[model samples]
Target: MITDTIEKLVAKATQLVHLFNYCELCEQPIYQQVALCDHCVSLIPRFQLDSLSGDLLNRPEIYGLYSKCVFDHLIAISPYQYPMSDWLKQFKYLGRWQYQRLCCRVLNFHLNELLKLSDFCPPDIVMPVPIHINRWQHRGFNQTLPLARTVAKVFKVHCNADCLVRQNQTGSQAQASGQLRRKQLKNNFALLPNETSYETSNEVTGKRVKLEGMHVALVDDVVTTGATVSEISRLLKAANVAKVSVYCLALSL
Candidate 1:
């Protein structure tokens, strides 16, 4: 009995040690709640509002930068550069779930700041860019789902993973040019039949009308050439969603 008890205790201790958080970049101990150490967090490249400085309304370039191609707004935490690129590869291909926490912490901070800007309202619901069934099965996880869930929880909004579905296994867009990527992504997403309406109370005057006038935030791990967001946003617009905003961990420059 004593031997069994000791073994059980050792197992529990091993589990606890594994649960302790460490920075993926520096491999240094960090707060249990966050995946990144303070120094590593500071090292991650960030986007600045100044880079977006221009008359957004009159300047097509400025408008296109943030609000174009069917989405009303874009919120990206970092540029797809250096350490972020390496980190994302590990997170997605290697199944580093801890990286999700790191992503959420940074995203939450930026999202909150963006919400403070004029005319920016928190989205009614959050959705992840869906992966094809075959790819999902092979990977054993849809990487964007965790990001969507975390963002939804931070904003107190609902996350509906089933709202959109990828109909075919479109291969990687990594090498495709912008025009080619757009062509490849066409007609790839379809809304689930049962999730057409937003649920709400009478005080909120909720009505079943194919996402009628509802704002949606789409979450993704990265944005490259924006083919994914563009195609998905096109589908959401067709459904009459009032607005679509994209939130991504990184944006390819």
Candidate 2:
């Protein structure tokens, strides 16, 4: 590939910006399309499986299944090997939403990968998994929604942050066995009793529901246990979502 003068200048400028923003974990510079710090990048896992079914149906957390990955879309890319040890800071404490946008933007380059995963081209809706009202209230925002919105802007699909919501008071699925995890979430998800048409906002309040299905791409900030994705799949299935694909910025592996 020939590097033209303007293109070279733009690339150099990008590298400079990233050098200043070098990954906190590895202390090395980050560059365009780079998904992880060197150390974090080295931690990426390779879990051998007889099939994806174990991760999907029974022991998904081992694969960080979270029910949010498989059965959604043939997920193309992920940069999930991050280790943000500050339990409070990484998720809820230090306001990490700003840095999260880069993940979505990085994904813009992976649109071709996402498209190739499906026999069909692009999907109709880019849906971020919804956080509960209480969680949203406590955290003051939904992290994945912003990323999904940017992805929608790039991909030109309708970004529907309102369709699938995390119901209130659901216990965290941080570390649990598949059976225990499922039990913890018994009857936790519910579809709001209302309309999910194109004109609607695709949200669910205590008394309302929004989101219809043609083809949906489930978006999330991270996937650890397949349980979350599986749970999401069950709900979308009930809602008549035609094909559920997943597009996430990070994966536990």
Candidate 3:
């Protein structure tokens, strides 16, 4: 009980700090909870949008970066560069939690813009690409999970983290070649039995949620070779998921 109280207090304190926060980059007082000011947010480079379909992958340059594609759609905030690269490094490696909020806010902003398009279709369900349990223990959290929840909240869909499991851990793909990534990630991911249901907290339950023929959004922090999400997409397709949309923070090329 004491621990819970202390956590609550810390959370409340964090909220208050955000409520009166300054922009981390510009040093301007920010009235809202966002870590960056509006100007800084606008200054972040965007992945060019498809003029017709609103899918980033529909653009030739972005599409050509991947060796092969399995997911039907790709939505991303920016190309992996500059401020985004720096922020992601902090959030994923240095454990700076504030950058997570910054990334989520940027993603939410872009997703809202995409929703304005007439042809855009949101997924029925969303999930983050799973990290191995060993990595989870070392990292203490899967960075993509919060981003997945952000997408789910924006789309008003259930965020189900329990459905997919990463069966193995591979070496850093940041500097690895596409073929090597594909080789290492081969058969690295597996899905849990579809009968399992997850609570909002992602705890497992007896209540079954059907995934057959459902559209799924797979969220990830970055997509370099597309090997990881592609492998995961193959598993989802085998399970009869009708469509898999990839949502990511950045595309590395």
Candidate 4:
């Protein structure tokens, strides 16, 4: 009985350690698994929840920017700014693995809240916008993969990285104007042949999975000019995907 009591105490102590962490922003001891403490989390800028909907194009700010969009919907946690941008750069360029875990947890929590309050339809499949093989080799990872997997877990859908692919390596669009970005992004993406076979929830073993009529959540780390995702969305549309929803960590206005 005494040994059992000791083991139970040790387990509870370990559980507490896992549950609490120092807030990334404020360094306060936060009593949750999320990296940011409540105070710091509140300080992160967010779109007014009241204005969000199934189609973000309904918002004047977003609509004015994307007057016409190929993708059916958009969901994002914050505008591209401050700590979010810093976190992404650190994880993508510098490869701070902790930031990857931080980002996944933060985005997962934000998406959970959004789903609870909105009538948004969960997607049939989750797909991370693919990077060129060359870049993948250089970077050793696709920065969006972890975020995409998190979304797939939340929606309980297949995360297919093999279907859509970045065909050409283009120069950075960071400094380019929207018009230039769009021009450069044209034909930048292509889909794998539909004949490709895979294991999927809707199909039997050894059968091919068709994207036709499936709703896809295209996950990305950020949306700057929206060129990359828009181009990818067009490709998915050509594949007969019934819907394509853009989900990203941040949006640059």
Q: How well does candidate 4 match the true structure in TM-score terms?
A: 0.86
| Cα displacement (Å) at residue 110, model 4 | 1.2
lDDT of 3 by residue, 64-157 (tens): 7753778888887898998899889999998899999999888887788788878889898998999999888998999999999999999887
- lDDT per residue (tens digit) for residues 170-217 in model 2: 656666776786676655666555435445234532433235457777
Better of 2 and 4 by TM-score: 4
Each prediction's Cα lDDT score? 0.76, 0.57, 0.85, 0.81
lDDT of candidate model 4 versus the reference: 0.81
- Highest TM-score scorer: 4
In model 2, how large is the Cα lDDT of residue 28? 72
Question: lDDT tens string, model 4, 11-49?
Answer: 999998888889877898887767776577667776655
Error of 1 at 204 (Å): 8.8
Q: What is the C-alpha RMSD of each candidate to the true structure, in Å?
A: 5.8, 8.5, 7.2, 2.9
List, residue by residue over 84-195, the lDDT tens digit for candidate 1.
Answer: 7777887788888766667776776666655566655678889999999999999999989988987887778778898899998878878888889878888989998798
Better of 1 and 4 by lDDT: 4
For candidate 4, the clash count comes to 0
Please give the ranking of all candidate structures by lDDT, highest first, separated by commas: 3, 4, 1, 2
Angstrom error of the Cα, residue 2, model 4: value is 9.0
**Clashes in candidate 3: how many?**
0
Error of 2 at 124 (Å): 1.1
Q: What is the TM-score of each candidate against the true structure?
A: 0.78, 0.62, 0.85, 0.86
Candidate 4 regions with alpha-carbon error over 4 angstroms:
1-15, 26-33, 37-39, 194-198, 201-208
